[model samples]
Target: MEKLLGEFSIGLFFWQTVLFLALLFLLRKFAWKPILNAVNDREEGIKNALDSAEQAKREMENLQADNQKLLKEARAEREEMLKEAREIKNKMIDDAKEEAREEAGKLIAQAQASIQTEKKAAIAELKSQVANLSIEIAEKVVREELSNKDKQVKLVESMLGEATLN
Candidate 1:
């Protein structure tokens, strides 16, 4: 039993040593370099992804700032346009008022001129009527006063001469 145990112990020790050496060689040849390269590649990939994220974040911030600037400029332009519109509206109103005043003055002047012409025509008609009435009154008075035929003829001749002199 001792011999059997001793031989088994020796065989197990030799096999364990051989297996250890073979495992060391396999790790060096196949496992160690690939694992280290995989770790390095993973780290480089993480770093590149972080850099790309930072760049995108900066670009987004710049875009946000540009948008704000554009918004402000648009508001300013709107304000300026509104101010110009108001000024133009005021000027138009003033011009319209001036035109209305001028038209009113012209209308008043025309009305006054029309009134003056009517007044002159009315006065001329009245003067003509008065002159005709005066001539009629004079003829009736003279016909009543001069009844004798010869005296009537002489008085009419003398009155005609006096009228011509006057």
Candidate 2:
């Protein structure tokens, strides 16, 4: 070991050490700076991408909430519309029923009035026929009782004169 160390010069070791240190310094100044800057830029880009992804996730959640709210409002509106339609339908049905009842009552009243008129007409005709039949029967009975022609002629003349005076 001592022989090997003695063969090499102290000046040669010093020159080699200085050359290695200068190469290291030059690499750090030029190559290492650019490489480090590129690495740092890549890291910043990754962080920005992560932040954008997180923002997109939050936006999606907000959109989902808005969609849910819109869906609920649509359902509520549909329910309200259905309720209103049912009410209107019921009202229309009731109105139609009432109209039918009114028409039926009118028809019944007309039938009753017609029946009453016919009954009154029949009664009047029956009374007139009865009166005429009573008159005929009285004439037949008087004719049957008066057998004498001269007495019947005198009775008829007096009845006619009394009727004319009245």
lDDT of 2: 0.93
lDDT value, candidate 1, whole model: 0.91
RMSD list, candidates in order: 8.9, 7.8
Q: 23-91 in candidate 2: lDDT tens per residue?
A: 999999989999999999999999999999999999999999999999999999999999999999999
How high is each candidate's TM-score? 0.59, 0.66
> What's the distance in Å from true for residue 132, model 1?
4.1
Name the weakest run of 10 consecutive residues (lDDT summed) in model 2: 137-146
